[model samples]
Target: MLLKEIKDIFYKELGDIYPKEEVNSFFYACIEHYLKLERFILAIQPGLTLTKEEEQPLFEALSQLKLEKPLQYILGTAHFMDLELSVNENVLIPRPETEELVQWILADCQEKKQFKLDAERSRSVISTPLNDRSLQILDIGTGSGCIAIALAKHLPNAKVFALDVSEKALKVAQKNAESNKVDVTLLKHDILDPELDPGLDFDIIVSNPPYVRELEKEEIKKNVKDFEPSTALFVSDEDPLLFYKAIMDFSKRHLKENGRLYFEINQYLGKETEALFKAHNFSEIELRKDIFGNDRMLKAIKK
Candidate 1:
């Protein structure tokens, strides 16, 4: 069939399910992934024809999209921090808000390094250099290793580690780490397990833990609610702060003096999350919003 023919079918079938522009974008993205063509190649070469093998997979992906399956999952990849990551039902699709979370951490870490350098230069203490001082970071419940791998890539002086309860999730994260070409130590850890304590020290501890309460499931989209792994997305309604509390307690035990803690929190519980840090004697707490102006990121210092 002609390239324009498939494009027309994409618009006709998916326009109602997705916005017109989104359908157009998805059509192009699928073509790029499956057919090895650039985004506008079809438009430029209007007479392009797809062989049977190429048409089969593209049509299958379109059918999945009509059922509201996420395009990222159907494509088996998601872009995060300018890196293409493999994603499947085993791991949650990386979101833009999580990308914002990563940017915040990177900015703070880089700024802190600069300030330290400036202070040394002012004091004429040339003996210690930035490269000599290494940072250690631990990411809890790293779904697809997005945060940990991004940190490792950007923070050249940092040693990064990731912990996840599900071995399946960790397997996916491990592939992402290798694909990103960043060194990240993956550990099988259940943060909620009372017997397991993070005994190691870290300069930075971060998490985008399971914060969605059961009551909030109704608010989630069908694509996320039905297709994504529930264990990575939910907490009991009766104890919505379960993971935060555990991480805070764990931070107290494991975070080095003045070490920072970061979380990508639920927008509705910004104050409550901050208060949890305060109750645990954590200081310098700040709750910040995402690009959409929702309170989605929090940072605290263990003093």
Candidate 2:
């Protein structure tokens, strides 16, 4: 079958469901993944054709797309911070805003490391050598271990750990950490359990937990609402800060002195979320907007 004909068929089938540009993107991605062809293949070889085997995956993906399945799940892979992660229905697909959150943490780590090096070189303050103890980081609700693996991969000097309530999610996270060649300790622990202690002090504690309230379900897109794991995305409207509150309490016991707490929060409740940190005595509270100009990230420091 002609590749261009399949592309046309994709447009004909998905054009009504998605925008024209998105349809084009889906077709190109399908071709690239299934056929190992570049997006510009059509431009270079306008008469290109596909074998029956090559055509099957593209058609199958198109059928899934028509059913509003996410492309990442259909492909069983997602890219976050230059790392390609395996994903499935058990895990939520990583998003751009989460990438921004990871970037923010990376920038902060680099800046702090440089400062420590400069201070040591100048002999301004006597302190333990940086190598004496590795930086400790814990990622809560690590559905796919995207944040934890990225941090471990980038900050080689940091000891990274990730926690999730779901054993299935932890299995996925463990696989991702291994595939990414990063040492991340995956723990099956529920953050909401007040009595269960993680039993470690972390230099950094971060979470992108369930912040989407029940009242906001209608605001979510069909693909996200229908396909993504609901437990990873939702909270009660009456207590939208349930996870945040529990994490705050956990940080009180688990976060080291002057440690950092980061969260990817719901856009509509930025002020409310920040207030929780303030009430918990976290200093240096900062709420950041994502590329879309939405209040989507927050950072605070343990006093």
Candidate 3:
């Protein structure tokens, strides 16, 4: 069948399901992934045709889309911070809001130069030449290791570690670390556990944990609600601050003196999340907004 004909059918079938621009973008992505052709090629080659074999998966993908399955899951990959990451049902697809969170962390770290150890060896400050010390960063509830891997890539003098409750999510996160060519330690730790060990001290502890209140599920998109892992997305409405509380408790024991703690919080509870940090005796607390101006990120210091 001709490429234009199939493209027309794709739009007709999905236009009701998604916005016009999104459907158009997805159509091009599908062509590029399946046919190995650039989007402009479709425009230039008006008579472009697809063989029956080549069209098979395109139709299959369309069927999945009709079911509201996320395109990232259908493609088996997602791009975060311009790094292509392998994703599946076991992991939540990385989002732009989280990317903003990463940018915030990177900006803050870059603004300061500390008496850190050299990258060549893990030696003391005296023994190793004073360079950008490898700051220790721990990402709690790292579903796909996006934040951890991005930090390792951007912060050359930082050792990044990630913790998650799900072993399956850790597997995906590990693959992403390898793909990104960054060294990130992955650990299976349930931060919510009352007896959870607050392991080694860290210069920074950041988490984009399960902050979505259960009552807010209805506000989520069908794609996210139907496809993404609920464990990585939600908290009990009665106790919406569950993960933030646990992380605060963990930071108390694990964060170094004057160390920083960061969180991507629910917009509705920004003041409440900030209050938790204050209650925990965290100083220099700052609440910031994302591109949309929603209260989306929080930063605090262990004083």
RMSD of each: 1.6, 1.4, 3.9
Candidate number that wins on TM-score, 1 or 3: 1
Error of 3 at 52 (Å): 1.0
Per-residue accuracy of model 1 over 1-303 as CA lDDT, tens digit each: 888899999999998888998998999899989988998786588899888888999899999999999999999999998888999998999999999888988888778768778988699656455441378899999989999998888885688999998898999999999998989999898887766765679989999998998999999999999999998899998888999998887887889999989999989889999988888898999999998999999999998
Candidate 2 residue-wise lDDT at 213? 91
Residue lDDT tens for model 3, 164-200 = 9999999999999998899999989899887887558
Q: Rank the candidates by TM-score, best first.
A: 2, 1, 3
Against the true structure, candidate 2 reaches a TM-score of 0.97
On a 0 to 1 TM-score scale, where does candidate 1 land against the true structure?
0.96
Q: lDDT score, residue 149, model 1?
A: 90
- Could you tell me the lDDT of residue 191 within candidate 3? 93
With a 3 Å backbone cut-off (N, CA, C), the pairs that clash in candidate 1 are: none
- Considering summed lDDT, which 10 consecutive residues are worst modelled in model 3? 112-121
